[model samples]
Target: MGPEAPRHAYFVPGRIEVLGKHTDYAGGRTMVAVAERGFCLAASPRQDRRIRVCDAACGDTVEFNLDPELVPRAGHWSNYPMTVARRVARNFPGIERGADIALASDLPPAAGMSSSSAMMVATWLALAEVNALEDRPEFRENIMDLTDLAGYLGTVENGQTFGSLVGDRGVGTFGGSEDHTAILNARPGHVSQYSYCPVRFERLLPVPSGYTFAIGSSGVAAEKTGSAMEKYNRASRLLSKITELWREATGCDDRYLAAALASGPEAVGRLTQIVQHARPGEMDPKALLTRLEHFLTENEQILPAAGDALARGDLARFGELVDRSQLASEQLLGNQVPETVYLALSARSAGAVAASAFGAGFGGSVWALIEAAAADAFLDKWIQAYREQFPEQARAAVFFTTAAGPAAFRVT
Candidate 1:
């Protein structure tokens, strides 16, 4: 057993993307808010070099010898903590400690709520505490700030971080770090507007008075391992090809869709004209134009316009933008699944002021901005309708109100 040590608990919130879903991987911007629900862990150091992990929710426990060479095992939830620990050991020299960790969560995995990212964040925090990384001068010398650490952990999962457990460098999906940012840096009652090309936080937009956010799960899991991985990779490839095409025609090397947008509406207008006449033979005949339309519209119109509406407390206008973004997700981005589309539409019809399918889409959940006073009634009606439509799925679906919460914290 490891040496006896003091115990501490940690919590890391999950994140919901309000707009600009797949755009993050292509260097576009996104709006993300931390959810109240997330993963929680209680950990203590042990004298032995063995590590034990317990998942109270799943009634599963795993034990392993602490080693820098630990690798992820398929279908095993223990891989999350093991991978984080291995990364810390591999990256930080002179760290030869292990801990017993107990994990639990109300966050639904694969619900587009970033449950996996939350787990990664919590695991890192626990390891830091047990290793005394904060107090050790050597470990603290080049220590990462919360935001940087978040992005680092994200890269670790995507198989981009140096010394990641998975040999391929990613679990499968090629995604960006918006989830990490929201999980580690979001403030309560506000949403973060960030640019991914350079990964910087631009601004914080507060929730207007009298309004709150609610998430309704479609009950279809957003698995990134199977065919979903192919679809996600395809979207990213299309975005890259579009950027290359734009550079070839306009002589702009900015690569980011946001850059083209920054050149003003006239630039976007002219680019669209060029694309129309540019010989569809070289482009992804069906997706290129639609993807460009969605990307340009999001950067040039929806995001900024929605930011203004929310800042000015114009919930009605903000709601309109939400609906429009959902349309783009379905028609242009092609990420929406039938259940998610139905949930967003049903929320609106059930009196939600504005509703959109949030997160990566193709499954997961939809978030609705609605009057606080009417939240309960809206949730009840929406869930009931969803159950009637998807009876078998109703057992797995989740619906509830949530407020923005702190990204993460140590309880003791």
Candidate 2:
């Protein structure tokens, strides 16, 4: 190792999987990219073997001795960085000669925001900067001359991150390749962008601007490396296999699909069942999409009940949809009687317009999008209602939609 020295800080964004769930692990295309929420790391090199890790939010410190011999166990978020160090060392022999790593994060665990993956990727990128490793001409540099690595470092990091987090011996990098991929940037610390197209299903190509979504959580902190993720991956893989079989049996390929989207309605429906087992509120993407579509198809009482208000030029129906969606989410999608849903319900119950769970589900938070002018009233009412229903989980965050998706920092 040269004495070039290592010292730097990086702010990396969180990733969101808007669509194409379960496809990434199968080497099939999945749409995912970093979001506004993020994690930051500040580091400086240490001459000896030790890692000084810190959590800015909670003011916690963890010092690990960079012990390669030690295997990671459950419950330690630190395992992710260690694991990245391990992989890098495997390639460059002594990449982790000596280093200090300080970490700060705002990403929520098990929120389907890829907090674990973001942390892992942030660590990898940080390591890469410190080592000043040779920049390969292509996205991934092959470890051996005989084998070529594919995709950006984030893709590789994601594969490792999810697989490591979920505990599947072989899930993410199962036959990963680097060809015809939509380019995503790998800024030293900034969020990267990827290609996003209006996925055509039954909905309009350009979704109506006024339309809003609500998300509720189960309030349970899920084990990212435990049964929940594992079950999804397993079922996802099986679905991929079935899609392959179906394609092979019939020469015609599915029209409205990428190599990944072969699992049309039936496939998504089945995936929904599997994901539901893991608790839809907690983000079984497969099942969440299934339920979302199912809502569009049936049990649309809320839309008609409350949304009909918006339709009848009546405000009450809109409020009802908000209230009704929250009730439905609590009963089906996984809002565990927390204040978020109640707040969301309050926004409608107090008469602001439509409300639903717009964030990741399972029990953490809920979202409500209402008329711009009525927003304050809605928020105030929602807060009061939420405080009454669930005293604890009553926190609110407000954000609006904009032109944001995955794109490279410097696209050629």
Candidate 3:
């Protein structure tokens, strides 16, 4: 690539978890997919360890050093780009310079979508590409290098545990599951993930095509996902033990595990009870009890009243899932936000299906799963209700969707 060659920027879409909340990080089950909206990075190599970050939306140029000891803290959006530069230095050791990255994004700041991870992916890709082209005598395009860079960046940027989980290059080529957000469950020592093969995932999850997802603060959610659990080691052990029990029990009979998963199964003989079932609704408790081990294993989608849209062959089915999931998450997980609740209720009154909050709850934005045809009406209703209730603060509940997940493109 030459100076005249265009600099490349990648738009890695953030992902949404359709089912299995609080499950992924706890070694339970989860389902996530890239949302249609996300962040972008335009990069060109620099001659020093300093990466210049021009945040177009915020109109601020945050200049930071790629030194590992001086990593950025969470909620600092520039953390991702800085981490990428630092990790690259730690991995190859050959080229110790940073790059200039200018970014503008549409992904909601703190929804459960993992916008931070998406940013890492784009910055990592851009930096790697720049290195391969410019510093060739000391460079290589080894995917290992990229993965190492991502992981090191994850740790150096997000914290040590995070770097270990999703930053692995091994999973990079294959992408990741929604459960990846479970990295929140990670400790300082290690980050782990589970894999299921012959996966039969149904992806009817809707990504708000033309709209945007927004997150706001209520000042209540202060739990740092990194340090949330005091007995994380014990919890990790318990989760691991329960998972092993399922694997052994299912080794001979998978149906037993499957039936105990989604929906319900029936019919037991008086003499030799033939069915073992997991109760409907939240699957976490049953999983904790080693009674079930199956996750929804599907992508995010809107849920209409009928059923899953993909499973039902209706595009409307996708939105239906979002609507239902929002309600369920509130009832089961306790992550409900008044703002989110009000948004959904109002959206529903204005013709939306459902509305719900994101992340560890208590704060952030509301996601409304509505009929596509009713979007305009819902927005009008939300605006009106928000203005009456919170003249200044309520304006942040806005939501919408954009393009798909991150993928490599041919710049040449």
Candidate 4:
């Protein structure tokens, strides 16, 4: 690749998990919107099997061979693109060419805005563009649509096999398709609801007129790596353990916690009993029960009602439901930090209709819904409150307002 070479440009936006916290992977539903901020990439094909990526913002470059056996450079940002390259190489064979990609992003990294997932989606798009992977038989057979592609990409991140695509070491997070779904399938000016474990679109509700989301990054890096990875995965693992118990007790092979609970009206009570009576193993029974409680309330009660509130223009009711979701994240999921908690509470105090910390929330950002006219003042007051409370975090904290944005696409 040279300066004179023609390049394909693409943009992948970050996302806001507006209502569903830690519910996607459990085969549950979530409402999400795309952020105005995201990653932009210019990629050109290479004649050889070497993929080179340069981060324009950070001035970091990583080059690796496009091989299925490629091992990710642990803790390095390159692990994201490298994982995509490895998975693409394995899933679609006879890909002799690679790419020279230069990327830049306005989205904050590790701030729970799906920056990492956006990077992966961008890399996958670049590779797919240069190689025409979508034309491949395997790709066509497995990924029939964007929804299917999102599900497959989720597996790519979590090291799970999708259809006939074999599994490999992922970026080391046991997560789901929510981020990918929103990135690939989001509609502008609307928050979309989706269910995972074979991603399906439920419906889309237009964001109320004159309302926009103000995001306050808590200045806490919520990178799904290191100790934070364990905390994030713990929530996911609890769902898995509960599903395991459900299968054992009922003699059913439902793959996800959501599926088991949806089995019957009495499924919830039965699962709760199962969790309460489980023999101790990898997870404490008490922790399992809390996870169950959160999932039930969030997936069954709060998400649908919130969506309905927004549908009917019931902003007050919507705010109250969002508040319940936030409390569940704090009390039941145990993923909220002092910074995030304060951000949510203070945003409400600052006149946001509703506010909550989102993403894999051991430490991350919060989203506050407010009038478009008041966003600036709300942001000012919210950030001032946050900074006054935690001065050390003020330097890293970022605040912005955005409406729902479009999904990932080629920038022709």
Candidate 5:
């Protein structure tokens, strides 16, 4: 790679979960909007089959030979870009040469804004360009669809292991495709509605005029691995466990939680009845009941009505749903900490139309829907309120207003 060689630049947007909280991995539905902040990458083709990746934000650099033997570097951020490069090499064997890639971003890492996914997408897209994969008939015929690409990346991030090979699962988060969808499919002025079980996009609901999306960081990092792994994995597994209980009790063994939810209130009522009357089981009955409550509230009401409210410009209703979603996150999901809860509540008090903590939630960022006209005042008051509580943390905390943005795309 040299300065004279042409470098292709790419932009991949970060995402904010607006309506759905901790529901994607349960094979449930969630609405997500693309944040204006995202990852940017510049790549120049190399003469050798070795990829060099530089993280501009943290000044970390990793260089790896594009080989089939690459395994995940557990607990390392560079593994993400490495995985992207490995996936490209594995899927497109003809791409012998790699690229010199440099990354930069305004998006804050560990804020539940999908900063990690943005980098992965950026690296993949850059490799796509550097290898000229689209020019190959096989590449154009198969790997060109944006949704499919997003799904593949999502699997790489959270998919389970397959024998000795570490298939797609990166870093061990076990998350679904919501973040990738928001990064790859979100359109400007619209939010994407879709389900994770079947991985289909329902529709794009428009963002109403005179409103803006505000994101407030909790000053606490939402680190998904190490200490948080058990809790995050437990939340996902509990959903499956309850669904299993429903199937066994009702003799309807072939149903997902989302499908049962679609069957309406009576269906859920039956499950609740069974749960309440059941004898002491291996799983904590109370904990199972709490999770069931969160799952039903989102799949039954908050998720379905959110699209309609946005379509009809009913932001107030949407705002109320956001608050409910947060409450569920706190009470049932147990993902919120004191810092995040206060930020959300304070933002609402400062006149945000709706406020809730979004993303993987063990203390990440919260989103607030505020009037476009009052955005500045809202930020000022929100910051003041947050800083008053923890002045030292205020330095690392980030606050900003964003709107829907287009998915990852080439930018010359």
Candidate 6:
């Protein structure tokens, strides 16, 4: 960590899930963008295989050996950086050096703007730079492009194997690549649309001119730990169960629910029948059906239509579609809390063009689209509205405006 040590620095932005909710893991589509705020990190290589990370803001530091058997401290912020180090070591062996990383962030922790994923990405980028992981045969063979890197990083967080690279313990979430994809690939001033389970790019639509997004953090931490982790993973597990049942009922080998539904024209009807006739103790038929409905309506319908609406400058239609997404998240995905629900409704009433609670959503934040000229007034009104309703949260809530920001990159 001295001036003479070779160093690399990076900035990894947080992300907003514009349209897709709990759909990424199911091989579904989502519109996402990067937030202006994120993590800033500087890393220098260590001669020995010992990784040490210091939180510049808090002065909290964690040091660990670059070993595959590294166990993360439960409920500690270091788990994110530790998981990234362990995964890198496991995936690309023969690494003789580690890194000394110091990081600072402006993004709120656990407000569902992907603070955790951003940290993970920053950690990986630092390690990759110091150890030249990208030039390694293992890394070159596995990660072909930014999209592939995003997908692989997602596996690092979810404990899923990416191609020939193996996976071990993740940070205890069964999420997908949406956050990682946006963090790595979002275009400034435009919303990027993508589909996961293989990470495909669909299109990019400009944010309607004269408008910006107003983000309101609900002050309820949506950390993917403890009970919240169970709830978040349950949504993912339900989708997996649906795919399993679909394959069982019909002899298809579709890997995801989206693929299962796309296998035939009668797929929906057949899946509905399978759910209805499912035996006791197999899975909750009602939850499975509701989850499927949300996925179909959100991914197959609302997301694409919303993108088209934005493309055509149809603000009214776009707002309506976002409303549907919010309702579905509340009723079907069952991720929304009262605070988030209130934020979405209140944002609309406060005259946002479109609004919805976004991210892993047991309790998180909401994004409201409004004219740039009205942003200041809109935030004031929106914050006032939230304050009147949830006074306790008003002190913890954060309100800010940002245009779609740049992706993660080297800080030069």
TM-score of each: 0.87, 0.55, 0.59, 0.99, 0.90, 0.99
Which digits, one per residue and each the tens of the lDDT, describe model 6 over residues 326-412? 999999888999999999999999999899999999888999999899899999999998999999987899999999999998886
Give me the displacement of residue 78 in model 3, in angstroms: 3.4
Worst 10 residues of 2 by lDDT: 198-207
Separate clash counts for every candidate: 9, 24, 22, 0, 1, 0
Report how far residue 384 has shifted in candidate 3, in Å.
2.2
How well is each residue in 344-401 modelled by candidate 5, as lDDT tens digits? 8999999988888888888789889888898999999999999998787677899999
Order the candidates by lDDT, highest first.
4, 6, 5, 1, 3, 2
Residue 115 lDDT, candidate 6, scale 0-100: 96
Select the stronger candidate by lDDT from 4 and 6: 4
Residue-wise lDDT of candidate 4 within 331-381, one digit each (tens)? 998999999999999999999999999999978899988999987888888
Stretches > 4 Å off in candidate 1 = 1-4, 65-68, 134-144, 161-168, 244-285
Error of 2 at 118 (Å): 2.3
* lDDT by candidate, in order shown: 0.78, 0.43, 0.45, 0.93, 0.80, 0.92
Candidate 5 ranges with C-alpha deviation above 4 Å:
91-94, 132-144, 160-166, 244-255, 260-282
Model 1: weakest 10-residue lDDT segment is 161-170
> Sort by TM-score, best first: what order?
4, 6, 5, 1, 3, 2
The digit string of per-residue lDDT tens for model 3 on 1-412 reads 2466357666555554434444433323343434446666677777777767787788888787656444554445665566666655555455555677777777656555566566666666666676663344323332234333333333434233232233312211112223223222211111122222112233233344443332223223323244432222233333444444444544533322222332223311210121133234333444344321212222112222323443444535545555566666565444566765666566656654434455444555555544555555666666777668666555444445322333323333
The number of the candidate with the highest lDDT is 4
The superposed Cα distance between candidate 4 and the true structure at residue 14, in angstroms, equals 0.3
Whole-model lDDT, model 3: 0.45
lDDT of 1 at 33: 92
- Clash pairs of candidate 4? none
Ranked by TM-score, the better of candidates 1 and 6 is 6
